[model samples]
Target: MTIPRSSCLLLAGALAFSACNTGTEQQSSTAAADSLHHIVHRYYDDKMQLFPIDATFNGEHQYDGLLHIDISEGFRQRLDSFAGRYLQQLQGVDTSGLSSNDRISYEMLLRELNMTRESLQFHDHLMPIHQFWGLTLTLPQLGSGTSAQPFKTKEDYEKFMQRMKTFAEWADTAIANMRKGMATGYVLPEALVVKVIPQLRDLASNDTGNVFFGPLKTLPAGTDTAFASAYRHTITAYVFPAYAKLQRFLQEEYLPKARSSSGIAGVPDGKAYYNYLIRYWTTTNKTPDEIFDTGQKEVARIRGEMEQIKNSTGFKGDLAAFFQFVRSDPQFRIFKTPAQVLDSFRAIEHKIMPGVKQMYALLPKTSFEVRQTEAFRAASASAEYMQGSADGSRPGVFYVPILDAKKFSYVGMESLFLHEAIPGHHFQISLQQENDSLPRFRRFSWIGAYGEGYALYCEGLGRELGLYTNPYMYFGRLSDEIHRAIRLVVDVGMHAKGWSREQALQYMLENEPLSEDEAVAEIERYMAVPAQALSYKTGELKILELRRRYEQLQGGQFSLKDFHDELLKDGCVPLSVLEEKMKRRFE
Candidate 1:
């Protein structure tokens, strides 16, 4: 998700909304509209700055010197306090006279606040931390070299070390929180726990090759040699040992109580949590059964397409063997280097731009780039797009993992570029950023259903965009598409139906030739973020439905260019909201 300049050119507006001069009408509306934005921005700024670790990620630097939060019941009360204020502000906002764009933003903001407050009622604050995705380990990544935190000056180095000292306190607090979670039946899956233990075990190493030692390895070249060495020594001798202690605690204490079950249904109010997440991500009231059924139908349909391709290609082998052949073929191993991997993506970009322009008039002003996945987290990563700063200070990027380029096939590379980079995330997010009327938060969000769902819909356009040409390559797209469809079944099956990791993997391999490694990683992601995989197909299905209706309604009048521009202009909205926008534009 490291936003680069190649595959994702999110050239957003360079200036913030601060630059627009005000007329009396502008000033009059500004009183309400501007106040609304100001109040929301102020809330986030105060909340994040008050919690410095959060600040560092959002490109705010004022709280770099701070770490550690008082997450006692008192802290939970404070979160409730903030929620109350925002809830009131959301209630007070008048959406009747607002522009359509602002109305959408207002609705999103309202939904987000209600959801958060409802979630907070569970005092998830009481379970403020867990080993799987804790802040203790993440803070180091935020501050050190190659991180968002600027580390050139001596003060920056000193600040990180100071941050490490406070981190120990956070780790202790994290353990305390986990203990609280255990008493409330809010433990992570035993399967997920085992995986996390190794992560801590890996980080527990003292070697310079480790990610934490990155600051030591790439200390600013101009720093005094004596100071650099001393700093490195301090981190290795002290910081590593502290992290090791936290790791030991994870190994010794937490893993024992971790549940074997995978679903939120296992935890307190877990079923409700899953329901909230479903509506939250999908932006609809889709029941688990509904999503599960859709997943099955889609998987069957996509499989039918694959079988047709297999027939045309005359692959005489059975379906599973064909999957094996497609995945394991020697010809697919053309990428021997990172440059080769990037070259494959570049080739895709060059070949597809004309086709892209043919279908869509609106394009992101941002440029895109390709980069290796950030090495630290690459092991747990998938190909993803990282959006650029809304202000266009940083270009949107596409990150491809080339950990073993030769081992990874080039079959599905182009379709992936289309999804993760241009004409997908970069296009959608950049369009949102450039919309001067959108509330700031709407421009930057993590709505898995709408955002990721729409991205998959974008991928459905691969052939028209000229990427999925060869039969093998087209099959590859089908293969990737099946994976998402399968996620709906397996995720629900594992958590809801009590299917084990081995069972899920067997089901996947029966249907597709994903390497054992790839299958396991994909399934674990489902475990980590349940029901998220369902969004793509669910959302994609709706989009395809919309397109079909439009084609039927417009007949020969249909303009693909106009269709695309109209869709992209609304950015990421709830499916229903998107439907409304499309109807207003096209009907």
Candidate 2:
């Protein structure tokens, strides 16, 4: 993500406001702007205190030692109160004379507060541990020393020790919460629970190669021998035991009670929950049926494109056969080792840079990298970008899962890199994090419709970026896009329309070039986290529509660079807010 000089001027104007006002009026406007900024910053500061682990990720190191059991009833009550308090404070701010950027911040915060308060009604706490997300997955990454938690100092190590101790308590609370969920019919799906069991069991291992020992392996030079011993002791005594306890609870107690139904709709008030999730994840009022229909149309349109590519390649059979050939073809499976797989993605990054530099006047200051996903979670993980620290200590990482390099398909590599690495998540997220003019909350805020949508939209830039020249690579781009489109259909279908896991898996396999393993991982991802899979396509379509509207409006005057800068300059925003902002700028 790059900000053009014009955007810098816009930000300047926003901060200083118009110079035409009389001195007295200008002072009043300044006061109101100051007040609004205070409110939003205070709101963000309080939120960081409430969610300290997130604060750590955002590079606020002061709260690194703190770990809140967020699913606990007491914690939820505090969170609800925090939102209510902010909403009340925000209502007092006068916005009539505020800058456009300040107004967008106000609107974003207001919606966040309301949504947070409203979402508390759901029993999400009852089933806090899920296969796709939760502390169960996140804590290991943090403790790995390769992640956000700093291990450069003795104090840093001590802080993490405290976090490890608190995590044990968090796991106990999670167990209690899950038991309550079991009593209330709010437990996880059996499929997800089974996946989680092994993860916990693996974490419980006291083996020297355990991920929890990662920090001890890479301890800074001149570190005290005694502290290192204590760290190992903590992992052995507290961390391993904590995971073991959690594993036993899931395996012995919770697994039998896990719901057989695949969707969130299987739980109490499940339909209403899914509907709320639709709004939360997509940031839209779109009904599940609406999204499902959009998925159908998009799938058909992309399939037609796939057919053309198939014919261009002179394939003898139908689209399904082409899919099979692409999936199993040795030509597509070019990597024999994980390093080769990674190098291919790096090559895609290098290949696209010249065109990317030409198309965008600005680029992220943050460094980026491509890395292998940790082996423990690779089996279930999807390729994703982890944002770099605001201070630039960590580079934004694109983690690819390569369970078997021999089976790794190059077909989607170009598109995948375009989406998850260079100009997709890396650009969108890094730009948001780097923009200093926006309020901190807005800078770090994630509206899936805006963020993921922008990333998905970037995939279409593949051809222009000079990497999708090969027919198979172009087909790969389509495959990635259609994968998201398929998500729209299957995520909504299973969660809202009562489609089974098998049906969802079948839908994915029939519609895309994914293997059975790929299809299963994707379908089950939707099952574990309902409506989340809907974000990529939903956001992508809205972004694409906005671009077309602006292109048509501006005609020859339209600068793709300007459009991109404007889209990213304000950072992640709700689609509605993004549309309003774009219209105000270009219309």
Model 2 clashing residue pairs (backbone): 1-427
Candidate achieving the largest lDDT: 2
- 395-469: candidate 2 lDDT, tens digit per residue: 999999999999898888888888898888998888889999988998778888778888899999988887778
User: Candidate 1's C-alpha lDDT?
Assistant: 0.74
**Could you give candidate 1's per-residue lDDT for residues 164-208 as a string of tens digits?**
667666666767887888787877778767766666666667776
> In model 2, which regions exceed 4 Å deviation?
1-25
Task: Compute the lDDT of residue 499 as modeled in candidate 1.
Answer: 78
True-vs-predicted CA distance for residue 251, candidate 1, Å = 1.6
Q: How close is candidate 1 to the true structure, as a TM-score?
A: 0.87
Query: CA lDDT, every prediction?
Result: 0.74, 0.89
Q: RMSD, each candidate, Å?
A: 10.8, 7.2
